[model samples]
Target: MGTTAYERVLSVAVAALHERDPEQLWPLLAADLPALCGGDALIYKLDNWNESEGTLGLSPGVTAEFTALGDEDMGLLRAGYPLAAHYASGPDRAPVTARRVAGRSWSQSRTAQLLDDLLDVDHVLGIPLPRSTTPVTGCMVYRSGRDFTDDELRLAEQLQPLLTAVEQQRQLLRRLDTPSQEAADVALTPRETTVLLLLGDALTALSIGRRLGISERTVHKHIANIYRKLGTHDRVSTVLHAQRLGLVPTASAARP
Candidate 1:
């Protein structure tokens, strides 16, 4: 039997939460989310316009097409496409389609024309992440045919919290990926960070191993590496030190 939409979303949620590497999450989602949300293709952009720049990810083929735009097209994109402008001007982070945002004027709008010419798509559904700041962050769902239906829009909205969870995990992974002055001396490898985070949850070596799909012996090896790197001899102190170093979230905010 085919999976229900809810089941599919649940499957996505599980897979996303299991992902340990922040860099891999985008491609993982981009692989399946477009079809789930009723679009031909999807591209996720994170803090795209920031000075520090941002990351963009999608299926490899589409990634090339999306980023190969010429200077003029790049300039046009930076001007804030309709849905991006809508969120940038206010607090609403709801997913919106280009047709809905541009209405009757969409046919003539430069942004619409640009998308058609560039992506060969007639409509876009911007799923901006929840933000109270500039440089809207999230994915854009593109399709060549009709605009997303109300049901599809609602489905996209329902997935927002899951996306937020993934983003939160991504931020934690980012901290682990970047070494600040304090953390420079104590930086843990991505695998070690994952093990440390699991340690914070009080999972045993065997449990962590099972969760990570590794042998218990390998889990112990990672745990030992984490302890040596964090200058801790045991799980409790290791997790505590990791939290202090901002390598993992605080107790209340730790992964559930």
Candidate 2:
């Protein structure tokens, strides 16, 4: 892809962050991804984690093109693909290429074998989403005949972080649109929200303390409250869950 294609794709991806309707997010992805990545197909999956129960949620109501293979494909995908194991393991947001994973006995996986027969898929590249945070979302590119060039792979890598941000904001917008009692009960305070905003910016507790005119210990205290309210164990999940609850400020909203 040329600089123009790269720029356009980036613009669309950034726009996806402000998309008013969460449901439109995937259709937008299906329509835009092929042109962006030079791929034959795309798939997106979202995983949600609860303190009580672990969850792997495939975002429903996606357009058929993204899910043309049908719902049963999940079994094949889980059995053959590395998503579950990847989610289970830590350091949550690294991208995994099919080439890197090709050593995983694909021939032995019944689902992978079925997919190969059905799609004639020769190559794939994937990035798990909501970058740098949990609930284990994944986005994958499929090519039927050729391996991804380093350039195309680079493009996927570049877009992964942007789309991860988009997913966070999309979920936030969805929650804001449909007011829920549960979300309401768990909403962060004005102070906690301020701290989370800085956290999303990757600020340290000292920085947040200076910004908020609080001590580092106080910053940590608020963060602990934020985590407990959000049911998140660490900083990244707290930041992401804050984003989902519309507690973190959006990039556009932060600008002058």
The candidate that achieves the highest TM-score relative to the unseen native structure: 1
Relative to the true structure, how large is the alpha-carbon lDDT of every model?
A: 0.75, 0.61
Could you say which candidate leads in lDDT? 1
Residue pairs clashing in model 2 are: none
Q: Write the per-residue lDDT of candidate 1 for residues 1-256, one digit (tens) a residue.
A: 1268888887877787667678887787788788888888876777754323455566545767766776666655555467767787788899989789889787688877987887788888888776526777888888997889998899899877767766765765764534457875675665667777788889999987766656899989989888788778988888888888877777887854
Error of 1 at 78 (Å): 4.1
TM-score of each: 0.68, 0.56
Q: In model 1, where do residues sit more than 4 Å from their true spots?
A: 1-3, 48-55, 78-80, 177-256
RMSD of each: 8.4, 11.1
The clash numbers for all candidates, in the given order, read 0, 0
